[model samples]
Target: MIEVENLTKKYGDARGINDVTFTVEKGEVLGFLGPNGAGKTTTMRILTCFMPATSGKAKIAGFDVFEDSLEVRKRIGYLPESVPLYTDMQVPVYLEFVAGLKGVDRRDVKRRVSHVMDDCALNAVSKKYIGELSKGYRQRVGLAQALINDPEVLILDEPTIGLDPRQIIEIRSLIKSLGGRRTVILSTHILPEVSMICQRVVIINEGRLVAVDTPQNLTAQLQRSQQILIRVGGPEKEVLSEVGKINGVSRVSVKENGADNINAYLIELKKDMVDAGKDIPPVIVRKNWSLHEMRPVGMSLEDIFIKLVTEEKIN
Candidate 1:
């Protein structure tokens, strides 16, 4: 329920974001990823109505972000990278304050605060002042305030930036649970978080949109060749020479295996060489070499991300 078209934001000669365009369908969780100084926070601030774009257009839940700021704000709950909170306010009191600011009815504020506290696992700290809470608890309090309004869309920027592994998992689970009920735009540099939590990803670099696709699709699109790892107990040179002759095999490299007389071979095949995996085993067998193991090495999200960013810089 979000649409952005050629969104551009700039501060004098320095570019914040340029020609940034993407969409988040209703109930879709979109991961917004980029390296430092890549305009991720700039884009999110524009989407959440915290700042206006220099040009282009955006709509949230069908309301124009620039023209209908109030309507857009009412439909979106934002947790910025640095969450703004009243340190002296108690946990529950903070949420109640947020609910009121978001226009929740006075009578329903109590129930709404309670529901968000439970959702964010902040019930135990309900009576504690935000200033006295741990960083993790403060993060949860930030999230609880974001959800206090039960908005149709959630815009979270680095929701798990400083938490421990356990706290990160808890927050990740909470974000996943919100999917299908609220459209979410999660902005973070954490690759695994994008892989585990996002349905699709929008990657930006150097203030430009670099790639946008599901993680699996992006991996497939960016992979230039197929890689297969094979270990064999045989003469290294002979094995490498024979494997190189197989149809569709483009390149091969051999590394010394730890096991005695065993060598590990990394074989690169032509793009879309689906049958090469099956073709190489027989070649080794013809030479009477004992095959130890064979498996494909798929490119991970991190690999694809690095490749995209590096390529963008080169071009």
Candidate 2:
């Protein structure tokens, strides 16, 4: 549904997007991740045909974004990072205007507007002026207009930004519902949003493509060490020495509670050495150490994102 090849966009001496290349398959929800000023908006603009790339090529729904931009525009639904709306117009009114602007069939305007209003949960505020609506409702109105033409590919830039929790949940669910049939490219800085709604994530840092994979795969790739948090009631020095002596335990460090009666530690193991986990737990138990808690450290999307972004900065 989307294809980009060696895409480059530069403004004077500054880089907007640099040598970026990736694709999004039909029926896939691709989450675009990057820090602020990371060229995400620049890339989205190029994909939506709002602006042409300085070099390289992009196609949406089989239509070239530059050469065949008209067809691409007809096939793509774009909700920009900062949604543009006619604040004085009512929900249905604005949608009706956009439908005509997008050249939807004259007779189908009413039907299309109604369908999008219903789909985006804007029916209750259908007659309300956009300026009178809350940010969440205003966002819905923006989303409703994007769907008025029923474009095949949806390019959403921070669709859930500034929404309340309930509204965020509603929008997230709405994006999930649209994924398979819509070929969604969701852009945002929120990691959980990517993890929850995207089937796959494309992480970009400093205008460069850093990684692209399923959420599970990205997290797994960043988890190089099998880390565990352990708390034991014993002399802190003795505990550290014993943990260091454990076979396959490559590194051990006390993370907390050094002055207190109990010591807490974070253990890093040699690659693929977690199978020796059994030996450590057993040794602690048999050595008269009182175990309070032992839990596997969880990897979050934020952790993976930070690690990737930091690595990019270093290189």
Estimated TM-score for each candidate = 0.98, 0.94
**Per-residue lDDT of candidate 2, residues 1-315 (tens digit):** 899999999999998999999999999999999999998999999999999999999988788999998989988888988788888888888899999989999999999998998899888987788889998888888788778898899989999999999999999999899988889998999999999999999999878999999999988777888888898888888888888899988888888885456888898877788766667888788789888888878689999899999988888
Best by TM-score: 1
Show model 2 residue runs off by greater than 4 Å: 258-260
Model 1 Cα lDDT, one tens digit per residue, 1-315: 999999999999999999999999999999999998899999999998989999999999899999999999999999989877899998887788889999999999999998988899897987799999999999999998889999999999999999999999999999999999999999999998998999999999989999999988998887789889989988877887888998899999985565777888899989978567789888888889899889988999999999999989899
**For candidate 2, which ten residues in a row score worst on lDDT?**
270-279
- Top lDDT model: 1
* Sliding window of 10 residues with minimal summed lDDT for model 1: 254-263
Candidate 1 regions exceeding 4 Å error are none
lDDT of each: 0.91, 0.89
